[model samples]
Target chain A: MRIIVPIKQVPETTNVKMDPVTGTMVREGVEAIINPLDLYAIEAAAQLKEKFGSKIVTISMGPAKAEEALREAIAMGCDEAILLTDKAFAGADTWATSYTLAQAIRRIGEFDLILCGERATDGDTGQVGPGIAAWLDLPFATYVSKIESIQDGEIIVERMVENGYEMLSMPMPCLLTVVKEINYPRLPSLKGKIAAKQKQVAYWGTAEIGAQPNNIGLKGSPTRVVKIATPQVARFGKIVQPKDEHELNRALDELIDMLKQKAIL
Target chain B: MEYKGVWILGEQDEGRIKLVTLELLKRGRALADKRNVPLTAILLGEKIDAESLKKLGHYGADQVIVVEHPVLRYYLPEPYLNVCKVLIEKHHPEIMIASATTTGRSLMPALAVKCATGLTADCTELDIEEETGNLIQTRPAIGGNILATIKTPVHRPQMATVRPHSNKPLEPDPQRQAQIIYEKVDENLLGSRVKRIGFKANPAETASIQEADVVVAGGKGFKKAENFKMVHQLANLLNGAVGASRDAVDLGWAPYAAQVGLSGKTVSPKFYLAIGISGSVQHLAGIKTAEMIAAINNDPEAQIFQVTDFGIVADLFEVAPLLIEKLRNHLPDKEA
Candidate 1:
């Protein structure tokens, strides 16, 4: 089996600052790291390679710095990597973004599976994975937590739904967006690190991937942001901590009193 | 079709309407009424009852567009998207709101891409701009670190997936009337690339967390997976549903259904007990509607304490057992 894992580079900051006027992320000098969820995708692919003698390939679409994420995936056990970077790829919505990835996958030739994180933390849209599946015309599943079984021509997996988990069986040449619960990622090996440094990532752009000019990036994206601003937190509760054992008991008594006054207990 | 009315995606489970669908309708009603446009509800399923259609009318839908077919019995992303594409193209609704449940979370994005429109996911707040008549979608970004308000100026139908429990459902009024419009699904277009193997539901209504009036949640402070048993024991004692933070869910301490966060479930219980959750902003966003919040954690600086009405600084391993014992004593009739 052969697999393609899509990874994304996001800002390391949890409180990512946004441009107050434009409503876009202020990405001038923020340090970037692989999206936390994509690690699970890489780990899932690596485990398959170890168990089934499959080859692992990772693809990332971003600025030049995104190659760092691809190399990190390689270090974690992928066989090859592709970096889809170009100025035209900037400001791409999930539609144009997934379309670009679909074109890249077509360029990469045949693969049994394409893996992606359930969503990206930065954009936080789970759209691209399914969008890619739509464009490539493949069976796809999202928020998958476990691969119950996998073999020639088919795979059965557990996907998280609204109420409970659903066991799904689908044929190969399918795309899966894995959840973080799928597996714990392994640290890069010494040999893997050296190999990752030496491996060259195939860089593909709009022209190389045969992506249509009209459906490439900002030009292709239909959604335009009108504004962005910080939201107001509505709660006005008192936040406090007890000082000692005496205060602890007093606090508990006060809580019980409040609950009683409100007739909650 | 002038892209006028507000449309609510009516999501259902086993022929019953989901709460998120009702919540979306209420929000849709306000937006539609503000813009002085009729509100529409789109329903796709094999069978939909007249009572269900009436329910939509009572909830403020002026029209209900339904596409019933055998292939639409269960949700298949491809087929669902196709149905949405047909309705969206034909009606050209000015705004479409969907519940951020599993089905809508998947369906809306796919449909939005196909329609070349903008979709805001897991929105905590939604409104219409008075001047431009654009949709104002606000949601937490960066794993719920901060909330961001986004607007779509260039799109025809502004779409958003509202978090469940973020809005209250309007009281039903039998006097309200809505025209039920039936549509036929093209069987060929309804064919899905993904084949269903089977759908096995654990069947616990509270498992979704939306139905739980009281939720006992745990997080990374539990330290290990086995410690989650304490959290469940506490919930069981209180007769409340068990929930978890994303960390606990990802670490295998709790099932994904029990997760409470932006990417997970949004819950607003009457009483929420955070056993060990340190509280990420994403986790806090899910519980903002809880009438009262009580948190127990070892770290003093944990953000969970900020929103909690009652804060106890101690290890969950210790506090959980004590609370369970005290609660058990207080309510001897409490079910375990």
Candidate 2:
């Protein structure tokens, strides 16, 4: 069996900063980590590879620096890595993003399964995985919590839903977007790190993947960010101190009355 | 104005139509009415459930498109997207909308890519442009620290995914009527690699948060796992639901299903009480749409206060019991 995992590099939640002038994230100088959720996808892929004697290929579409994330995936036991990077890919939204990724996957040829995190930490849209599945015209399951079993032609997994979980079985060559509950990612070992350092990362651009110029970048993206600004903060409530038990009860009653007046009771 | 109609992506689960589908139909009808265009719904499944299709007319769909096949029973991205693509390609609707449920969220982005159009996810508000009749999508951005208004100025069909329950579904008129168009499923395009074996549902106790009306949410300030019971107790007293900040859930104080954040469930209810939460950007992204918010924390500068209608700068451990007692005394005998 052959498995492909898509990973992303995101700004550490704590260190993320917004530029006041552009209303965009300040990516420079910020620490980039393999999106925490994608680690679960990598782990799931690794587990499958270990069980089935499969080859694992990790892919990422981002700036050249994103190669670091692919390296991290390799260090976690992936067999190979690919990076889809180009100046033309800048400012692409999820739609354009999934299109580019689909083109890249087509170039990579055939695969038995594609795995990804439920959503990216930066965008939090959880669209790309399904978007890829849609473009490639494959079956997909999202918010997968556990893998029940895998047979020659079909795979069974548990999908997390609102009321409960549903176990779903889909055939090979399906795409899965996983949540954190799937498995804990393993830390890189010394031998794995050495292999990752020596491995060369494959690179692909828009021309190589046959994506239309208008469909691969900012020009291709339909949605535009008009303006970004800080949300206005509402005033804080004034604390009311009670002098005695009678005053305390009265204060509490007044607060409740106020809430009722607001129709929030 | 090449595009000129509204489309709703109808989602089905286990032979039943999802509530979000009805909600999207209601909203789609209003948009179509405002623009003086037809409101069409597209339903893809294994079999055409007549009972569910009939409800679409009541919910305000002017036209219903059904694509039924045995392979379409479970959500396969290939077949479902093919149906949507075929519908959009044939009719060229001006706008498309979908509910921001798990399935919709997963499918819409991919569909948008296939259509080569833009898609705004988790939008809290959707409106039509008076001049162009294009959809104006309003959604939280920068981790809920800012609300961004997005527009696809040059696109033929403006698309968006709305969070569930953000807007109430209109009352079923029963008087409304619509046309039903059945489309053939393309079996050749369907991938042979994937097949559904069986489904096992998750336990009920852990899954209740999705249907919760009044959710009592706690954050890192709750101190320890034992303190989470205060939130549970308050929820039980009010016959409500329990939620937790990403921090609390990450610390194992609550189940992952109870996590409320950008990466978790986007819930909007009549009443939401946040306890001991400082309100990180991700956490706020999830519940900022709640109609009424009450926050309790010892920190006077907590960010949760920004959107909260009422706030108390007191310890949650101290305030929770008192609040429960007061609610028990004042609330009506039956649950609202």
Candidate 3:
């Protein structure tokens, strides 16, 4: 029942603002926290570890600062942590990112399951998890809401679709991208926090993971951001203030007329 | 190895083409015309009827490629990935587009990784670069605070997924003719370790907010869960769908399926009504494509007011009941 959870450290994207003149993200003072969704992955792993009495290892690939997110995973009950940090890993897209993670997972050897958050907050693309599964050639499921059972050599789960929920069964040694509906993550325990403080996280670079020089960085990423722009926020801003009941009815009539003109009602 | 033609991975349900696929065909037709290449629709399913295949041509496809297999009857990543990889290799396409639905989101990324190509997710805009003939993909980033335009400089069949409802399908023309091709592959390519066991439909969901023409959303200012009834009432009156802000969903006042925001679901209904929502950027991200938006809140300077077409600075409690009563009385029963 050994499990692997991939986590990410992301800026509070809600707090990320755009400079009006430069049109670049103003990230100077924004605080970085664990991707809110990844906590669910860590929690799913922790719940399985408690039930099966097995180990849970958390992994992350980013700048050295990402180790703080790994340590937080330990505080939330992951047994160990690994940080894949290097200057070479910069500017990797989902493809290159997943390739490096697959190499790390190969180095970590065998595991029963790999769990990841549905998507990272910054990129908002739920591709890396499936990308990793493709690289590793493992069966995978996305937008999983519940894990119904884990029997001999197989696991059953429910995944979301357009209209309904589809129940699926996949062999062990598979991957899953979990949604927020999975479970409410538990807070870090005092004992777990003490252990996390003492746990020495292992940091690996491209060389240690035997990653191909061309496949671990900007050169390996097929997609490039050619331009970035702040979206213009424009509104009609028609306002109506009704001080009394009669005026309120008048306003309502006007609103209905607009709806009728738009053919929305 | 020259890449040519524009390919759209058409989605099918029970052997019928989905609306999203038709919408992609509309965009694909334009890009192909611009590039002077043929627009091809790739359909994979079991027992697809002839009429369904002909509809692809009517929409815009110059060629419709069909790969029928029982395993593909339902979407599992392994088999679909295998089939797509083989087809992509056999006939190199310059560009490929898919709808950012459950199937497309699941399959395209895995296929892109296998092919070692670039893929942009949930792109709102796509165009051909005049200089390099590259696909210019634009998508929102960091909760719609910014947009990033991406390109695949060295990859063949540059891939992207557009969210459903972001675009409309073109008018069908039955006079159009399309050449159809059927492909056969090895049985081993269809094997999969994952299996679908069952499907559970949500009967209580009368209308999906994603496909609804009108949406009535409520936020945290509603105070109590019971207050959501008014939101539902308004939606019911309009025969629309009810939506909830992230705050409302987090407070257990509404289901996550009804939640609209960066983390929830993106909706592009024709008309949207926001009540008590202060319009965080994340929530606004989901509804930015909505044709018209109207907001009601007690606060005069709420951020929602900045993006809405109509703004009412008043208490929602009084407004909701009054609006409901007025509509019920003034309109015919069926219309209301």
Candidate 4:
């Protein structure tokens, strides 16, 4: 079996904050790390490698610094890693990104399965996996939580939905966008980390992937971000602290009245 | 080729049209009227009657399109995408909208790619540009720290999957009438390599956070899983759904379905009560659309207070029981 995993590097969202004075993102200290959800996809690939004795190739499409994310995946048990970086890939929307990745995957030749995180924290689109599947004419599933079996050139998995979970079976050479419930990602081994450092990472660009200039970057993107604005949070912030029992009673009465007025009671 | 009409990829559940579909109709009506074009609602299911199909007209569909097949009963990506592609090729709609549900999220991307069109997902704000009549889509990005407005400048049939609960459904008008069209397509387009074998509903979820009008959420301050009982009790008293922050769900105190945040569910409830949540940017993203918010925490300076209309600084243990008592006493006799 040959399994491919697509990962992304994103800003650590927890540390992402806005500067009150400028009303702009405070990007100075926000560290870029592997998208947290993608860890589950990597772990799923690693477990599949452990069980089926297959090779796991992890791929990422980002700036050159994204190589660090690929190396971390290798430390976590990926057999090899590839980085697709180019100035032409910049400003690409999900469509362009999916087209570029699909082109690279085509260059890699045959593969049984591809795994991706449910969505990236930055884009939050969750569209690329299915978009790639469309480009490749492959069957795919999203929010996959469990892989029940993989045999006879087919795979059965459990996927999460709003109401519950659905068990599905798809042919080989399929794609899955996994949820966090799939597995608890494993920590990298010290020896694996040392090996990852010594391993060479291959860098691919638009030319290497043979991507069409019309569909590889900003020019290829169908959608454009015309404007960006911060949402203004509006709240009264009516805070009250009652130190004594009488004060507590008064506060409780006022709260009940407010709730009543809102028809929440 | 002129893309000419507004279309809603309508959804139905258990033979009845879903609320989100109606919500889209309400919003789609405005966009269609602005562009001086007809609005169409397309329904795909196994067995929907004409009576139910015509009801879409009452909600603002100038035309109704129906495609019924046993294979189309359940949503599978390939077959659905194939059928939608065929429809897009035939109709050449200018704008298409769908709910940002699992079904839409699964189908739209593939459909957009197959047709080589642009689709924006989870759009909270949508409008038509005055000059070009392009659909303007606005949605939160970077965990709600910034909102980006996007547009498909050069693609036909501009598509978007709108967030649920962002708009209410319009009032039904029995007087309104629509032309209904039934389509029959090639069987080969319905072929699929995937099969859905079974479905199991999440048993632990007593109420759906997305559908709830009131959400009572707990955070890490509860300290222990058992402490969630009070949160549940409060939710029960208020007739609300139980919600949790990522920390609570991560610690196994709550199920993932009950989590509300960037990685979880986005809830636009009429009222949200945060218990001990510090309101991370991701967490705030989920509830930013809520109509009213209140918080109860021991720390007066908790970040949650910054976004809440009301804040009470006190021990949750004391506050929970007392608040429950007060609500029980004040609730009308029939409600209590």
Cα deviation of B186 in candidate 4 (Å)?
A: 1.1
Query: In model 3 chain A, where is the ten-residue run with the lowest total lDDT?
Result: A15-24
- Candidate 1 structure quality by residue, lDDT tens digits, A1-265: 9999989998764444434344344667878899888999999999999998999989989998899999999999999999999999988877788889989999989999998998887777788888888788787888888988886788888888766677777888999999876888999999889989999999988889999988888887766555555443334355445566565555556655665565556
Candidate with the greatest lDDT versus the true structure: 3
Best by DockQ: 4
- Which 10 residues in a row give candidate 1 chain B its minimum summed lDDT? B199-208
In candidate 4, stretches whose alpha carbon ends up further than 4 angstroms from where it belongs are: A18-24, A249-259, B204-207, B331-336
Instruction: Score chain B of each candidate by TM-score.
Output: 0.89, 0.90, 0.95, 0.95
- Cα lDDT of model 2 by residue, B1-336, tens digit: 467789998888767887788889878987888899899998878776787788789899989988888777877556666777777888899899988877678778878877878899888778888996668888876566577788898876888999887876779888887788888756675553455555655454345565566788988888988878878777766567888888888899987888887766778876788998887656766787777777888787676776677777776766777776787788757332
TM-score of each: 0.89, 0.87, 0.96, 0.96
The weakest ten consecutive residues by lDDT in model 2 chain B span B201-210
Report the lDDT tens digits of candidate 3 across residue range B1-336. Answer: 999999999988888878888989999998999999999999889878788788789999999999999999989989999999999999999999998887888899999999989999999999999988999999998878788999999988899999878888889999997888999988999998999999987554434678788889999989999998989888878778899998999899887778888787888888899999988777888898888899999998677876788888899999999989877875667443
lDDT of 3: 0.89
Residue B241, candidate 3: alpha-carbon lDDT = 87
Better of 2 and 3 by lDDT: 3
What lDDT score is found at residue B117 in candidate 1? 78
Error of 3 at A195 (Å): 1.6
Task: List, residue by residue over B195-230, the lDDT tens digit for candidate 4.
Answer: 989988876444578877789999998999998888
- Which residue segments of model 1 deviate by more than 4 Å? A13-30, A232-236, A240-265, B203-206, B220-230, B246-252, B262-266, B285-291, B314-322, B329-332
Model 4 / residue B105 / CA error / Å? 1.3
